[model samples]
Target: MKNKEFIFLMILAAFLSATESYALDIEFSGSRHTVIKDKPEASTGLNDVFTIYDIKEVSFISIGNIIAPSDFRVLIYSNLGGGYAIEQPVSITGTTAFIHNPKGDMGYIVEDGDNRYCFWVVDYAGKHFDISSIEAYPEQDCDMTKITVIGSGDQIRYYSVSGRQCTLSRNIELSYNTLEWDNENNSYSLVEKTAGFEYLQTPLTLRPPFYCNTTVTVSGDRFLKTWGLGKTLESSIIEANGIDVNTEAVQTNLAPDDASNMIKSDGTMLGGSAPADFTFYAYVTDAVLHNEWQIADDPEFEYVRYRFNERDLTYTFDQEGKFYVRFIGSNADGSCEATGETYEIGIGASDLRIPNVFSPDGDGVNDTWKVGYRSLVEFKCWIFDRNGHQLFYFDRPELGWDGKHHGKTVSPGVYYYVIEAKGADGKKYKKGGDINILRYRKIGNSSGASGE
Candidate 1:
């Protein structure tokens, strides 16, 4: 019984050891170029594909650490057809394999039973390319700019033109394998790498124009490799001659009133009492052919009230209506225009008054004890019983408390209210007073005031 248990334990240990040593590795010789090993993407049945650049031919290839060497076969795939015949290695010695002067631009796969290992060979000799010059010029008809790149290469792998606010890039599709080896058919087959997606071939001379001063970069690739990994021969920084207009309008004066606790304006939007002076300044880019500050009654600028041709304007808004202000800037030819965001400026008379009593008798006339307010920015009100227990609180003047506590009607009595408020017109308020709650009872079709 002990011998039988020992034999079973030995067999289990050997099985785990063999499973751990099943990983295979391949090596290449007679290649002075660098090797790039790319792992397969997620859910792609493809294996790691090795890439070698600037090599005309590989002298020999070796597969090491291979288990069951007879079951492994090195197959070189043709790049022309999908169902073409596969080529075999010239010789195989132990775990090493060799091919006689293997051609470039071909994919090879090592079949180890059901597993497949893929690799690519690229002959990049005398295939170098460089950019001679990059020139930028404005169009004759409009303000659109155009860039032209002069280079000598098989294909442009990637190019980008970047500016202060915009960037345009064009890249080639080379990282993915659209055709994978099929074991059953002994040929290459088309496979969808991603669902509902197909690779797009980038054009060589698809250079788009830039709006501002930009930097231009370009690279070229002659063999199959990922974009941007190729050598970039030249990069140029260009200054645009055409105008790219950008404008901003901001309020400069942000002083609060001294007599009241008025919140300071952030210059984006201003409101408050009448006779307010608001100073607006413009921050613009590029050469301005014509610029103006306009004030309108509507947001769409259908009725423009005033127009100032200066870069800055300081106007006193004494009216009692909401106004909109914006700045517009244009280029010399008016082909390019830029407009700042419209700012809403409200100028209204400040008024806030609280009622002494309110009757929430479900009559909808004086149901809530809201205050009569106009342009009141900040407000807070608190209601308490005679014993100083807080019953209701509100921050906006538009909201009022009904004569109820804890979701039930309170007893008819006098309640105290405390208020702390600040108006948009820089007026501070701190007032408290008695609030009388009256309940009316209908008797014989006649309403009579009962609790007060």
Candidate 2:
């Protein structure tokens, strides 16, 4: 959502002057248990199909019945329609109902003919549903006037039911409508009012982890269920590393590393190790401290970081937007407050930190640049080339490093890798997973490689 907002593709917003939206006339009775059609005089019996449209709102009530009391349920649907993905299901309450992404999903429920009373109110546009395979569904012999369309779309199709030929299409939005399921004392309609809430989504700056395939929660949404860096730092900042960081991101210095974790709805918390070498902290204020604060020059994350209290005070978030990032440097000699560069993003605070770097000079320190899930429950790692070729694949963290092929060391010049580890729980399904990879420096043969 950085530059573009998510919009529902289904549109006819002002098809014929927004003011002249169509309306639906509704009537219901408790005794008959079916919607009463005084205006449209439609008859929806055991099996009948029709198309409905131009409907704005309807009001009525139905009586008790064996199935759905002539309310919303107890109805059949052949071809259903609504807005774009907005029609996604939030949750389900029926059995044997699984949702498939591209294959499409359909649902069906039967009324055991038991006396029951139930009614429900649903949002028309923002969301919709499909119901089929019912006793009356696809049965065209019932009645036709009982069903009609309330929207316009060639998308309306039909469903052939065993021993029945009734088919109906339901597609409408932005308005309220009502109908009955049966002809008993039950009648239905929409007449009450409800409340609505709105929110403004904020843009997130963190890129998908470069480690490998795994999930990371950004802002509040979880992304990159499995990831690993594949492209060189010079290629698209949005390589296999996940998410996207600008190519201009600093390499001389890295962004401060500060990642926090929250428990998912299932009580799964991703407690993984952060790059052990980098130090990052954040604080915020209103005024930009260009003079007092000396943040890192061309910080990788592009956020201002100043030194203070002898500690690395570079990535402090300016919550209040007040002011206060002073550069401070420390050496083997001593540490003191110093002015750092002054960098800025957005109004308050923002930036990502790349605490992990590979330059594994034979210094024998920070030696292994690899993904770790010591805390994540189930782990799966993948190594890929810049062209998306899968290389080394591991299922555990302890199995990292050694940087060898079948039996020899693999040449190194920034090979691409991704990880698909599972932490928290429900792994095989990809959850609290994160990605990271190994960076090795191939010098001498297995000998000098020491414990080579």
Candidate 3:
């Protein structure tokens, strides 16, 4: 009744006509005893009351843009157990005011106090049903957009952050379907409405660096210039605008004087050991960007990352191998790259010891004539007789001679041996000396024969 019009659908009208005998109606109230007649019912306060004047049951209630069953959930509550208790669920027809209640039907007084009952409208499915007035359900939270309207007519406008214009009159119930423009505030606002949550706008494109101008300077400040049309001194001045500068990555170049050394686990330089750490030194140069140095284990540069100190241009290698490293740098403006040449480092070459003697009588004690070297790059060993005839030859250090040539055990003698080995430092080492092969243990000796 509150100066608002109620537009009922055709189905609602027909249904109301059939149930006119019940005189079903909703009532509203104010603090000063002012009653609104036939208005869309809204709860004014905790004490506000609503009544289903003379209805036996309710199927649903229509409020704002929601038509019940199709858009929201409705529940009826009875004042019981010192508080309001939910009584039953109500189904709705998208077009009617109230239909037949399938659950426990109640033909009783509905109010806001102990003597009456109450109802709830729920947006259980996230349909974003906008309840126009807080007075409709003062105790329940309802979806609504709060807005302030100012000005009149062409000067009126709706105001909100990034708002739009308003078009509706003052003090009217608003819904998601309503769009009003306000001219005075120069912004748009939803009087008491909601359209769910808004999504973020698309991002703007990023612009690349641009070169404003490029001036080529000459050695002399004032250059002597000759012109046909006009005589003038040409200065080093080239002016332009909107010229994009393409950035490139710096090239990696390593110095030839770079050094690498193997160290023991105790941090001492490696002399003769297997598990030794290695350190690589990158000579500081203009083209080298210490912070951008990247070291890899394999030739393909797909190796494990090692800890490096850019201030010293050094990296420690815990494993043994040839590692590849390079320097890559880029300007802050992203307009140029400086890459250094790739440098290879060899490590784990401190231990290359060849035994001076071995008793190869197969007693498992110095049974094989071999060299002990960690990460040996390449190796070849040869044993010769007094006349320089090659008695035994071996290529792999792991596969050494057993003091035998073609299954024939050689007699115990002082044999001359030559070893050619490639160290992890990429350097070839040749060692020739006399190896005394003493037959300390015979094949079946009861007491192992001992000899010098």
Candidate 4:
């Protein structure tokens, strides 16, 4: 029983393999222009059709390896009037049939048993189209432009700058083999191809309703070789210049010992000690005839403090208050004006305080000795041991010193700190205090001495 089942399975496998291997080999003969074997775009509904470019008025097609020679029939159809089949004579020799003098842009169907093979023949001997020039015409309306393509072709395709297809109009349609007849089902069905792959008639001219930065491409049948050269036209509509105001608050004057004051603020809103110097810069997309920088006390600019007509400005904020700054740019006619981003500048009064106690344990609570500061522009801090040996030093008020020297934790005892600073409000700071580091010693652990 097992041997018989195995034998039956082998026979079935052979039958299936033989069925899958059966294919009709179709060949074209005679002097032809060219043959484009590349598969058509899936949207063309001609996935199974092979394009044949013929220069001569006539061409021959040979269909060989027919499963049944008597059952093979070669049928030709026109692309017009819903595709009507033309009566063409076929000469048969052995298992092959010869099709004589097929027409251009016509569909050919070869029927053998329940299988049907289809293809398209494009005549390339007489088709002629070329792109002369492309021009752009601006309209009276803003951002409205008319683009004209001076060329001729059977169809035209539009593309973007990045080579993406753009839809022109959906109502336009070109005739091609979009449907195939099913012999076994005895009915006509739509071809298994993606939709919206149709091309438009050439000599195209259209004005886009809106304005954008894009690239336009015009081409005929992309799959054909004899089709004329494709031309790309770039159209850019110029508009008013865009303006942006970039600001930076920099401290130019530094104390002789405060060399680490390298932090600069470059944002719309900034808060620091008074007497800050800020440089304003204007970035414009196009040329501007007039550029002005304005500083006001209120956001609405009800009372303007200062106004400067320049491309860039360096202003000093000596008073303690919130100020609003903006930049304006305009064209020669002044009809087109653009305002840049508004900057909010805040100047605070200066004050500084130092902490007396801090725990440097791993609990993350006050792990470092840091000073309580408000707008101290120029600062210098030093941490020293009882032996007068400096352990850490910093020139910025925001920086702190952990209770470690040379990568080792110092002894939990009172340390000393000295600070010399100057505020933006012209105040001076000269202070010194003791910093105590309190740590709980673990069992059987000895307190390590301070590192040098």
lDDT per model vs. reference: 0.54, 0.26, 0.36, 0.55
**Best of the candidates, TM-score:** 1
Question: Could you give candidate 4's per-residue lDDT for residues 5-73 as a string of tens digits?
Answer: 434432332222124455666666774444554443433323234444453534677778887777777
Model 2 C-alpha RMSD vs. true structure (Å) is: 30.3
Whole-model lDDT, candidate 1? Answer: 0.54
Ranking according to lDDT, highest score first:
4, 1, 3, 2
TM-score of every candidate: 0.52, 0.18, 0.31, 0.45
The per-candidate count of clashes, in order, stands at 1, 85, 45, 0
- Using TM-score as the yardstick, the better of models 1 and 3 is 1
**Candidate 1: where are CA atoms >4 Å away?**
1-23, 40-45, 79-85, 137-146, 153-237, 241-255, 260-268, 287-290, 349-452
Runs in model 4 deviating more than 4 A are 1-32, 41-45, 48-56, 76-88, 124-127, 140-147, 154-271, 280-452
Worst 10 residues of 2 by lDDT: 217-226
Best by lDDT: 4
- Model 4 residue pairs with clashes: none
* Model 4 poorest 10 in a row by lDDT: 169-178
Better of 1 and 4 by TM-score: 1
Q: Rank the candidates by TM-score, best first.
A: 1, 4, 3, 2
Model 4 score (lDDT): 0.55
